[model samples]
Target: MGVPFEDFKFNRQILNAIADAGYTEATPIQQKAIPPILNGQDVMGIAQTGTGKTAAYVLPLIMKLKYAQGENPRALIVSPTRELAMQIEENIKTFAKYTDLRVVVLYGGLGPKTQIEQVNRGVDIIVTTPGRFMDIYLAGHIVTKTLQVLVLDEADKMMDMGFMPQINRILEVVPVKRQNLLFSATMSDKVHSLSANFLEFPTVIEVTPQATPAQTVNQHLYFVPNVKTKINLLKKLLDAEDDVKKLIIFCKTRTSAEDVYKFLLRKYGENGVKVLHANKGQNTRINSINAFKADEVKILVATDVAARGIDVSDVSHVINFDVPVVIEDYVHRIGRTGRAYQSGEAITFCTPAEEYYLDKIQKLIKQTIPVSDIPADVFVEATGFDERQEQAREIDLQKRKENPDFKGAFHEKKTLTQRKKFDAAKAKKTGQQTDKRNKSPKAYRKKR
Candidate 1:
């Protein structure tokens, strides 16, 4: 057991809500972050995904803002994505269940009419994506003067999405004397810069190394030759692994996610499977996530962008249908499982073309993923000629990125063949001209 929640000296309402949520003990991040935040100190928190980071800050924020305030928000939480904003808002509501605090989540996908109305009605905490927050603030819907606490959740993701300018603007608009908090799964240079500018004499807390996977997650990798072989392997694993009760499959592209979702839908029917991607309507994505969280759906296929801020617990496994090109996302993807101290598995399928990214992921995670041999019972399909060439081309591109002077194998060979043809043509053209000149009277006389 970790540190008990009661040791922090919370009010009866917050403690009751914690008990209702079945959270008896605080995780490492919670233990370190809750105290400093409650003391009204600027804080920078670094931890991997699923480390109970949300509760670490949310619980304290609830304790501070015990009752509902005026129409304006007293606290603000900035998120990189609308999905993440909603997830944070859900956590706030879950913990603030017994309190009178009012929370509103603002995002860009839906019409602002309802969000504007929500703000007009009273709000204590505002969780919003940067763009939507700026839009509402500019439209005179948000009153930043009342804000006392400002939290930037998933700060690294905000940097990745290039929200720095909006963040700066937000810092300017909010009252300068307020408390600041920044939380991230990974601490990149960009995050460092944001922290330097966003905080002052702040408490810096890092529970684990940046981008480290949770210890509760058992990672397994398989080398797939192609898409068909990956599907074959996925089918075999799903059929054999009885423990894969709830799973999230991450695909590199929306198209791939849809294809995988369709396959799973055929097998499990509509009730068991759902797909989420940027192309999906906001309602569809939210519904898919809600269904998965409620245990109504057994599997969810999603692209990385659409999968952000998914806080579902008890997910048995996370399968990477395609290796993520963004190496940092590998941590986030696998971190979906093994949540709330539950033991879970993270299985990755790496095609030959994706091996370059797999290598990077291993390096970033500071450990090699255990490779599992394909079962003898499962058929390993042959890689097609075109697919093989594409894989080779992708590998060449990966190499080229590492060494700019390095010419790709296929392109280098084609260049040599073209050079020979060009030289031969030039020689033939000179010879033809010499022969024509010799046939002329003056040239014939000289030749004789």
Candidate 2:
């Protein structure tokens, strides 16, 4: 109601494309951020993931390019991860399907020669991770001097991954006078300070509270004893619940993700589970995502890198296999489910070490999660418990050795349940020996 479709110079083709994509009303961030973006004004948008921030910028970029002539990279967008960069590219292609704007994605894990070929052929838009962008830019493969627009998506994550130094270097290479757009799910002090350096009197747009998790997700927290106990608890939940359609289990690192994925497969079956992480090749990651979306796989285990920009709805559950260190990451991981007004559940396994992280996440989401208690009947053998836990740890360690970039160092927090069972067995044996030694002569005669 605020702005008619005719008000913006959006071609009929783009309008039809948007309608085809099942989008009618613009989301709050889209409505507010799009106008200034079309006007070539710098914009600082504070919005969480899944709020259509991608469209907020993509539509305007395509509109601007409709009039601009040469395709020597007029728009440059920098994302923190390969998946996110690919997602931005996908959104641009979807929105600009009818337009003539050429979009290309550049990220690590793949060779740069292919990206260089795309750039040489002339691209209107380039979506890339900061490292890859800088790599090619410094080599003079990309002509940043002619860049008309620059966007930094997921700015906070970029800073978190230590991309600021590279970003500064990229900024120095690109032309200073250009339309700048900065978008982040949360506005940390570093993000605010980074915005100060780029945006010039920009229009600020915020649809959701900073670092706030979605309301549609029903969150549940379980206080478990340790890593092994958490695995057992998860197995119980999986076996007991009949309604679980699909799961995206999030670990803090690629190592933990793979380990959890392997454990689920070994415990459940190979047909039901798959793992996605940065260590996986581009084709494998993409194929795994597609398989999960198609319901070919019931469980998709992944790290925080998979949290952003992997959009698949109808996900019945999101399991925090390990509590994320970053509070915003908790929001992002849970966001994989409960999308498009559909209700979903998010379950987190928190050990004593992760309790503080859960507290921070609760504050970030502005609500206390209802605690879920594990039913008391499940049991593990006393003496075999340590051997089982030790074996699991060994497998996880071996996985880390194979993939060095795994990010979940704290997932290895030792739990008390394993130790408690050992202590109880030892105490019972001691008591039995003492009773035998203290038997009276009358008791011995009665036994005879």
Candidate 3:
């Protein structure tokens, strides 16, 4: 608690809202980004999720747009996903409770009628996803000329989701001289390119290294042999650990998430388990997230889409049921816990096939995840032949990626032998033909 929010000298309305939200001290990002944002400078912020980064820029934007102005929105915030867009809207509403600021959230999957109505009623702030924002804008429902500030939260995710074209289109339509704020967990090359094109001589603030997890999370890794063993280990942990009051299990795909959800449901019943993924309906996904946040569900299984936006502060554990292929997602997945300076645990299950991704994640985060043995009571299942072969192939692929000359177990010896024989035969035939051609015409006739 270095500096209290009151020290920032925000207006009375903003201060009151902050107090109502139970926020006193500023986080590191807020401390570094607030001043520059208040001064109306373009800012590029690199910080992990759950780092109070939303308020870092949001608070200042609120302070700058102190009062409701013209009919059109004066500030615009673009997020990568619908969940994150809603979360940002919620944050703005929390901090703007004492003011007359009107915020409208826009995203796809839901009809645009209500969103259009909200915008038509007149808004001061528009928090939206790139696609829906463009949709409503192109439909002539949104006014961008009056937009004073533009914020791109989760900039890296936006790049990953291929929203660059929409973002570039939006940038072209909006006022070029307005304040620009970009926040991302990692500063990848794509993110840097976006920042260079969007922000102008921006104040760059980095609270931590790129792709690093929060320090408050105690991380551990378990090397499981196969999927069945991974499930067995999950059940064993849930049954044995008394401290897992609230947990989010992250999977790599929707199908895997659904499988884990069904497993947990059968064991813990529907009341205790809920699943969230793109396959679920929008309302169901929202309900599942809400239930988990309210502590009504002991376990929530989800994919990486929920990793960045879930703001539950007391999540006791984050279990990576599948090692994320996208290495940066590992940071976001573990970030769901250990939020708001609270201590939490992150446990990851890595199968042999996923070891390659695990290695990349470890290198990206710049830390070796502590490996722990399976509990003695848990039954360790034997790896089947198919799974063993798959693991071997994956290992060989990883090695060959490191050294292209290295031959893998899957490399066909028969093909190599056949190639050698064919090459020798071809060389011998070519040599004989060359000898015949080299012989003089008279020598050839004498031999005949």
* C-alpha RMSD of each candidate structure in angstroms: 4.7, 10.9, 6.8
Candidate 2 per-residue C-alpha lDDT over 61-88 given as tens digits, one digit per residue, 9 for 90 to 100: 8888874357588889999998888888
Query: What TM-score fits each model?
Result: 0.91, 0.82, 0.90
Query: Residue 70 lDDT in model 1?
Result: 75
Worst 10 residues of 2 by lDDT: 438-447
lDDT of 3 by residue, 86-136 (tens): 899999999989989999999988899999999999999999999999999
Inter-residue clash pairs, candidate 2: none
Clashing residue pairs for model 3: none
State the lDDT at 183 in candidate 1.
95
If both were scored by TM-score, which would come out higher, candidate 2 or candidate 3?
3
Ranking by TM-score: 1, 3, 2
